[model samples]
Target chain A: MVSKTEETQLNRLENQVDNGGGGAWEYLCLVRKLKVRRSEKVLKHGLSILNDPKKRSALGPEEWTLYEQVAIAAMDCQCLDVAKDCIKVLQKKFPESKRVGRLEGMLLEAKGSWAEAEKAYSSLLEDNPLDQVIQKRRVAMAKAQGNISGAIECLNKYLEIFMADHDAWRELAEIYVSLQMYKQAAFCYEELILSQPTVPLYHLAYADVLYTLGGLENLQTAKKYYASTIDLTGGKNTRALLGICLCTSAIAQLSKGRNKEDKESPELQSLAATALEKDYKQRASDKLGLLTSALRSLKI
Target chain B: MGLGFIIGVFGVLILSHAAYSTIQYRGLLKIMEEEFSGPPMNVVLELLLGFVFCIWAALTVPGKFLSIHPDSEENRIVSLSANLDFMIFNHRAKAFPLEIDMKLKH
Candidate 1:
């Protein structure tokens, strides 16, 4: 529906905003709208506003929130000098603010001073133990220092207090996968699936973990979950199609010497194989010949 | 008969050398166990060095003098012809050269 000229004009406007040609407040709002606080454009516009004395005075007391936002954005963009200037201004205005203290800790984090950042975050937590941002930052500091187990511990504690945080669950799952603890990752995915059962990605991830575990029972469960993923995505997922093929083959291998009644039927294997071949032929463009030949070699 | 005798003698010589090295290794192990009263690491290092020497001797001594080479030009030509025969026997004739007869179907 969007014409080419309109798209070009939109891109030009975005570029202008990105280069700090847009007003500071508009730029901040735009970056916030995009949920991209760490962008270089945010940092540049934030600095321009805070540097000009006239523009600085024009921002009334209520707009002091902009200073904190700008400082954090600057820290995210690795502009420590601009961040420090903003921090000094905020600290002078409100010397006893705990939120300002959190920003100070984040500044230390930006400086690669992990221990000092930890100390700063700990003192802030002691003053106000229920601060979620401080808790998350502590977890982030542990992660940045490559203490994955420590990060996991902190995240578990945070999740105990805030059990519904999907982002925290996803992060814990990722850490478990990095450690090759697939069972624990599956548990995390299970929680995510329980909370949001309709999400295709959670089902896909859980199926992948079960497939990696690879027993007859786990493979059957993985196949069911992968089927659900395929159904949820309307059969567009190549990986789910491949997973179905693999699980069928693995089940066939496992049940080969078992009782005849326990074996997955030949008809089911043939159906999965044919479906996979059709989907691969239809979807796989660059590796069409290779994938088709590979499926053919599977002998299903 | 002379070539067979020479090959038999070389084989016996290699086998005897291998057996002697093995017996010497066992004797060294027994000696270390009974006489050496140093750290365990020294015994381990000695055993490791013995193993390395055994493998090195096995590789270098017997194979170097016993390999039969077919390095004449006639042998090389025979090998090349065999490979050419395999290619010709297995090759399938194409209907046309791939670069020609380009077709577009919609």
Candidate 2:
């Protein structure tokens, strides 16, 4: 039984479709989202409207964007033939469009003709060297081919042009970590922290990298960052609590013979360990026993 | 042929420098061991050997070089488009909806 809210939404959608409103495609997309298995119903409705001679002629130039949306929806529904038909219509309507060219390249990719797809994107880039989407696609292709360095190089070049892209920075940082380039990964996280300082994940990640690098100074910094992470998360982060405990012990060992006293006190390590034990018991009881054993092995 | 020779010379130069550094490190370790009972020489030797092999592998591996075939403007297009296709498909399932949403608003 459809609820009152769902029925109201469906009625609104029907009214929009009946009146030839601009939001018909959006309505169908919403329906597609609600019942994914009923996408064929939405596609058929869209196709019927497109097929009607009067309706086709009545649609404005901007409304023609619906064809691409319908094509993508058809693709999602595994109706390749329908998608191809829509793409053909779109191509005929906008023959010289780079946007259409991108869709064509996407179709080639979907068809598993990677080399041909690459050629299409390359030509598109040749026409406009600063095309950001095409540039990102090039990096994605290198990654798909398992060319890590190539992907890194492409991302580096793209960042040179668009340095403010945080998503790209995060991706580059992850790739650096995968390559075990902790210093480089640290630099990326530093960029992220500088841009958005309050995000606990960046602090946690930066701390992890510094800990892995393992110098007295780096470990000290790592401990500080982990503390910041815990504070930011309101002391609810088990990993950050564990990090404080581990860093305390490690720093104590590293500074044993050195002039510098241990920055992390034994009392602090005990307190963090106690908090971690209680939190793990509350959240992950099964891991609680293992955590105790691990702490024992560490002699913390 | 010229590129190969240059690569070969570069590899040799790097290997010689690495070897020189390893010998100097070993001597320093030996002196430290005599004065202060430093770490085991065998462990230090193994680490140095591993570092040298890593550098050698990186230098000699010609596969690291970009090997795009039929190197021409057309082929460059092929490579670039292939890259773009990769990016598109990779983010399609997740990011396409966001793209469409932005398009609809515009």
Candidate 3:
């Protein structure tokens, strides 16, 4: 999801910090903003600033946020000691802070103390039942501890309160997909598509689920969604093109000779195939044979 | 990144330098007891060169303008409001108890 400019800026900042160019804080903030998984880089560069007292103070009030950032990145990196020390600094500075208490719960989670983490999250939830972050954390904890059903239940309950959360819906849809529950996954994808009709990812995912469900009506609907995905992505997504091909061929086979004019629109398959060929020709002409062979196997 | 960004900044610096040169020229004219005319020719040329550099850099920075377009699908607001604070990377779904699947199926 990161833009090219932002990605290049992140690389430049990382190099600048690595060479002691003194922008460790800026690099860490960009990393956070992008939500990138650069735990090692963040931990290394962040500790350099944290270990230096002068550099830490130079950030002023932002230093506390930097400490929290480093703490989370450290936890991701499995550096419990550094995370503990950072949390201790935060706790000492802001005693009775619910934010710091959340950090404590996350730390317990990182240490694999499931019961303690649950207890901590429960207490936090007790203080504020509408603590959405804490509730999500509880679900994530359940998922992390291999309690898939519990995670699903918790996510359902969480969605009851936060129905507008597309991310949670996506997470639930993904969990259902992994469990081979295409119907449930399709429900979640429908919810997501209803909320965000412009998002091609949701459309593509819904099409995938619908195609996997596999029936006359579902395959037709899946092909429609796949075409919508292609329109949304400007015909750049090979997966959606392939989906259109697959759905077309499947629908054709299922409805073979059933009617004189079944409205199958045989031209749709050739159009999809042409688009696929054009894409392959422009990008990887060397592997065009593989693509043609694969398409031939699909009978489209 | 360094090339385009540096060229842009250099153009900005040059434009500022041109402004400064104009001011210096005015001061020199006042000291010489002459009329306060326009900037020197070299400063005008420098301004044009800087403007061209800025335009070039603007058109070809780290990426193309379509990526930043408001209507492009790639620029869509997909996960801007994602509640990632609760995100956990270490998923153990594969290790989930098989009995639970049997229970869920029914």
Candidate 4:
């Protein structure tokens, strides 16, 4: 029932493989097509092409394409057991392959076997310590298990590998915030703000952390963060809320500084810093209040 | 009472839907491999069937009774409607509410 053109195309694909033109991806695609067509002949041919040691030598890398193909085929056939077996075989053979390892993790995770999957991912890390996907999954599993320390460790490990990953940094900051590790969380948020200066939420979160930590010395930085956040968000009230925080921090710092210095206090520095912080806070609060009133009016 | 009943119905559906979809998703994967040429259509059909299965599962299985938990930011315990609650928790939850606490973080 196949059209001549289709047959010719399949033949061309075979020729491409024969001539060393087919890469790993091309072979995988052929195997997938074989599965789609339910052509065992084609599937076998595709496998042979993938398994050919000569092809592997030419292709430069032989990872988990064949294993993935078999797993997909097995899953398509409703052979969960076979799919499971294929996964095991793939895991054993291509232990370092990302796709195979991830699929194995997903299958275990799907079965509600979180502990086993976590263990597997941990073992996987022993081999590929810098695998971001494995690290992220480990964090996710740890978080799911409510192991905050474990999740933090996993995320930290991931951060070590991918220092510039803003999302990872933000997530780590969020986790630290939730854990009430205010100082650590503040630093993370600050780093994120430094990298993605345009994002208002990072500043807001950082300011919140500074307020929670209850240090007035950080008020100046908090104010800058809140101001920047507000500007980026079109001067929204989120900025204002954060601004109040900055005000409080400044007051706390000035009062503490005054008491610490006693008669020797730098009165000029204290007054200038406090006045600057108070002004910023008041402006933010007023704008935020206006937004709140507008929101209330809209609701009504 | 209406809220409780609606909640009960909703709980049942959520459980059934998850189970049914899992089964159908597995089934569709097999079908896709067996007949690869028209897999897109089959994939769509499987998704549609998955939706239907979810609805059916919601209607039949009393999800509230099972110790089912979803790991998400919002930890929603299985709060069943009064009617479904009667059927599911009457025996086990005589002294306490049939609530499954999902610990999102340790």
What is chain B's TM-score across the candidates, in the order shown?
0.30, 0.33, 0.58, 0.28
Misplaced by over 4 Å in model 2 are A1-97, A259-262, A265-267, B1-106
> How well does model 3 score by local distance difference test?
0.82
Superposed on all Cα atoms, the candidates' RMSDs to the truth, in angstroms, are: 32.6, 25.3, 10.4, 27.8
After superposing candidate 3, which stretches have Cα over 4 Å from the reference? A1-26, A53-55, B1-83, B89-106
lDDT of 1: 0.66
Best of the two (1, 3) by TM-score: 3
Candidate 2 lDDT (Cα, 0 to 1):
0.69
Where does candidate 1 clash, by residue pair?
A: none
Clashes of each: 0, 8, 0, 15
- Return model 2's CA RMSD, one decimal: 25.3
Interface RMSD, candidates in the order listed:
33.3, 20.3, 13.0, 23.0
lDDT preference between candidates 1 and 3, better one: 3
TM-score top scorer:
3
Question: Worst lDDT window (10 residues) for model 2 chain B?
Answer: B75-84
DockQ of each: 0.00, 0.03, 0.06, 0.01
For residue A211, give model 3's deviation from the true position in Å: 1.1
- For A127-207, candidate 4 gives per-residue lDDT tens digits of 877777677766766775677898898788778878897767777887888888988998898788789664556667787
Give the winner by DockQ. 3
Looking at model 1 chain A, report the run of 10 residues with the lowest lDDT sum.
A1-10
The CAPRI category of model 3 is incorrect
Which 10 successive residues of model 4 chain A have the least lDDT summed? A34-43
Report lDDT (Cα) of residue A72, candidate 4.
46
Compose the digit string of candidate 1's lDDT tens values, residues B40-77.
54445545655555455555655445322222221111
